[model samples]
Target: MIAVANLAWRSVLNRKNTALLTILTVAVSVVLLLGVERVRVQAKESFANTISGTDLIMGARSGNINLLLYSVFHIGNATNNVDWKTVKDIVGQPAVKWYIPISLGDSHRGFRVTGTTTTFFEQYRYGRKQLLSFQQGREFDALSDVVIGAEVARQLNYKLGDSIIIAHGLSDQSFTRHDDSPFEISGILNPTGTPIDRGVFVSLAAIDAIHEGWETGTKRATGAAFAKDYTNHEPTAVTAVFIGLKSRLQTFSLQRQINEYRFEPLSAIIPGLVLRELWSMMSVAEKTLLVVSGFVVFAGLLGMLSSLLTSLNERRREMAILRAVGARPHHIFLLLVSEAGLLTFCGIIVGILMLAVLLLFGVPILHAQYGLVVDVWHITEYELSMLAIVQAAGILIGCLPALSAYRQSLSDGMTIRV
Candidate 1:
């Protein structure tokens, strides 16, 4: 076997350019397969970490995923707003350590505007208990002050004290703009590689203040909170509430109480479970990428096989010479298979290195674009398994030309085949 490997190595060196190109082809396939899998993994991690350190998320009775989507991530609108009275009642409970009331239904340049208290910046966490920190200035102390997310601030070219008008709805093109009460940019939040980077936050009173005259989602009458001199501005309702329990064990009990409340329909969900549910919804897209990458790997192996087979006729003279020098048919076969397997192993190594380098450079860009955070040097079990499967498939492909060479060497002993 050692002699066969040595011969195989020398033969591959003879056609070094072809061998290197074949290896490069396989390496590209490996990079694609691993890259797709890595992105899928990072996406799940980023999504799951979208909200953390909250024991339970309470929202108006709706799908658990829906509540999670609209409340924590600001992806969708609430079907029904949770009454401020109900939220206050929940917060007053002894089981609740602290709570942040979040009011939604406004926008600034297509980014969802959230209404919450200063406690939100202190208590809300993401990506491993990471608290919200300001990149510039400080939290919104005034009712009409808006704290822009990193993405919002960067994309909108907003600086501290820049007054911007809030749109009446989520669209940037909304005609019903809140021109009556423009909000000054108070602070910009540091990026957390989560949905928080895209949010625009303000005091809950500001939400009510802007829509003060507008009753029931229409233009009506009352003193706008932003325009007033800090009087009795009551927020009638909030979209959802983020709850931190006094005791982690009471999470289920509090969640049950919130879910079974008689005053209004409400749902309390564990953030982790809701995240799992969200990932389940996205599994199809991940699987689709995996399947496509798998096909690319298969095609890459076929390209390797074609390279070996195409060189077969050319190597008949080499095979005949080996046979003349007392090499057996099986020896000839082993040489070809060994050469192919070595090239494949090298390609896999090259691919992994390429992926690591690509990730090292690309992770920040991905976070900047989609808020997806990934570990550059981490390898998961799925990635290892994928490499194993590809290596096994390559070995099988390597056997194809090996068997053909074996047959050719056996029949042409002591003679050259044209």
Candidate 2:
């Protein structure tokens, strides 16, 4: 058996380039397959963790999905702004616990500007209901001061006391500019792994002040941006609001009350429900990507099989010599199987190393852009199962050529075909 194994090793080494190419192909495919599965699991985890502790999100009369997309995910624009009076009424309701109003529709460069109250720092929670913490400086205290999210601060390189010019519209390139009424960066927040990380938050009054000079140039001359008397100015409107109920049971009742309010047409969405619905909608795309990745792995195994079969023909003379030296047919079969097993195991190891490098670099970018926090080190159950399946498939490929060699050894009897 030892002599037969040595001959197998020699045979593989003789055609080193072909074997190496086969291993490389298998390694790359396994890397791609495992990479996709890792992302799928982590991305779902990140999405679920983005917003927590918040009971529901209330906004203008629109679909629940739409409210989540604009208010929580910052994906799309809010079509209408709800009346501040209605928001106040909701705040005063018996079923209500706490509510934070968020006004949107402005931007500083490409980042979305979120007009929210100071209560957000106290109420808004993310990733296991963790509270917001400031990396540097304090929360927005003055009307003209703003607190930028972590990604916004890092991308824009903002610091405490730095004044930033906010654009009039939500787009990166807006014809209108609030370059006149730039807000000073009062604070920069720590990473939250939520849409808030990509958002620029400020007091609702700050948004009003920036746009106060627009349409009517009356305030532009005197620079009396904020109305000294709060009630004297046109009643402010906010884009959307997040509501937290005192009890889970009060959620539906509060949503109904907000929807039936005569003040204006509004929609109230349960954040968890909306998130689930969003995931459901994306299920098809996710499944399709996974299928394609699986096929790629299957193709790699097929290529490995073909490479081994082709090499078996060239190594026939070596096999004949081994058989002449009293090596049994079963020993020849074991030798072939061992070579395939070694090549596959090596490929899988290389694939895992490649995946590790990819995840290490990918985490920061994913967190920055999409607020998806991925843990690079942890390998889930699915990944482990996939690794096992890859090795099993490699063994099966080996068996195909191993069986053919067994047949040849039986037919050769002693020293026969080369």
Estimated TM-score per prediction? 0.94, 0.83
Q: Which model scores highest in TM-score?
A: 1
For each candidate in the order shown, give its overall lDDT on alpha carbons: 0.86, 0.80
lDDT of 1 at 100: 89
CA lDDT, candidate 2, residue 401: 93
For candidate 1, write residues 1-418 as lDDT tens digits: 8888888889888999999999998999999999988888777777788888999998988998888888887888898998888888888999999998898888887889898888999999987787989989999987878899898888878899999988888765545678768789889988888888889998887887777667666644434446576555558898889999889999999999999999999999999988998898888887899899999999999999999999999889889889889998999889989988888888999999999999889988987677677777778898999999988888889998999989998878556756
Top candidate when judged by lDDT against the true structure: 1
Return the clash pairs for model 1, or none: 209-225, 213-220
Measured with C-alpha atoms, the lDDT of residue 382 in candidate 1 is 82
Candidate 2 residue lDDT tens string, 325-365: 87788888898887787678778888888878887898788
Worst 10 residues of 1 by lDDT: 218-227
